[model samples]
Target: MVFSLKGKTAIVTGGGSGIGKAISTTFARQGAHVCILDFSTDNGNNTVSEIEKEGGSANFYQCDVSNQEQMETIFDEIAKNKTINILINNAGIAHVGNIENTNSEDLDRLFNVNIKGVYNGMKAAISHFKKHKSGVIVNMASIAASVGISDRFAYSMTKGAVLTMTYSVAKDYVNEGIRCNCISPARVHTPFVDGFIQNNYPDNQAEMFEKLSKTQPIGRMGKPEEIANLALYLCSDEASFITGSNFPIDGGFVTLNN
Candidate 1:
């Protein structure tokens, strides 16, 4: 089977950096017109420029995925000019705190960005998919969705919600030719991890970095491009038979960590 996305259109939230950026670029490379949606206009534009430099089609959109008004407006505008065949809900925030340290505000912020953001994106895009009678939704979940992790109460909670959200959407739209799935990645080697190390362990950055890498059973973290490759397969025509599932891209973190 051929995995081709030529002539398709995709919207990737958080497409400005890390995993989202990799996914957006990969889709564009596979011949999909990608919309790089992010709260950071500069990063979004940079991603678009990179895609264009590689002779791939892409556009930048500054959007706060948690805001319903902003999301609705952007989706409306995109729908006017292009058919959105794929929606990748990837914008997320990581909160490094346990239940005792996580306050109401902390919990609310995670909920808004990680949970409601996915919800609003799907809700807005569902109408267009229903109209077209076919589409795919891929949510960015995490290993936290299926297993316990320390100091990740808020993050884990949000990802668990994401997993269920994918299932619900798939069930509701199965007959409509709309497929919904999710990817649960473990520690990925991204700038986010680098920044976290710099900010939290300025004195022993390298030591802490090694520690984080060993957390994955494979002795290292996964790469953004690896996750992006999995996403490309899932969103391609070859994956029409796959839906309502959460594919774990972790290096044995969820199943072999014991």
Candidate 2:
């Protein structure tokens, strides 16, 4: 029963696919009533179906994290019926380019989904957490936030914001019994990575995949489940003493890259 999330309610943005999906299912399995939010209705519902198939409780909401009004409304609605105990700000988009190639439009897009999206989710949930005087917030950041990553100008910019924001929230809400933490994952093996490789290196998919996998000192990309496991621990009661912390699950990418 250690690390159990039984009777807790969790809201996971972008929970339809990739790391989000893994986190959503894992939370549900740990006895949380998972609320999955995603722009894609199909993917969201599919995740719900999978959770239900495993006898886990889950609900799907079609959501766009950048839309502030929509997020507020959804959070209000969920709070009316369930006490949201965990909020995972995992919705984000990626762009591959240096500053020279990352135009204004790309920067704005990243700001909207990667930076503003996390802001909107937290804004909607913080009040409830404060009122309840207890809640857990886990944000999904990237190693790019802490270390220099080539061709990730805009991405790194937004993730850096996520990291600092985590600290701010945790510090501001610590006395309120709310904890906020972030996970900076290196390259995680997810559908997004597969699609990126297939689209950009279609002719040399295997080679490109190998190259990307080797970027981590572990000799392979981290698994979505691995990230989810860490997330689960952070959100569970076992991490009660933890807050305002940045856990880098990067497989030495931040330290070993020289």
Cα lDDT of model 1 by residue, 177-236, tens digit: 899999999999999999999999999999999999999999999999999999999999
Candidate 2: count of backbone clashes, pairs at least 3 residues apart or interchain: 0
Query: Which digits, one per residue and each the tens of the lDDT, describe model 2 over residues 104-173?
Result: 9999999999999999999899989988899999999999999898999999999999999999999998
Instruction: Name the best candidate (by lDDT).
Output: 2
Off by over 4 Å in 2: none
Q: Supply the TM-score for candidate 2.
A: 0.99
Each candidate structure's count of clashing pairs:
0, 0
Every model's TM-score: 0.99, 0.99
Local distance difference test, per candidate?
A: 0.95, 0.96
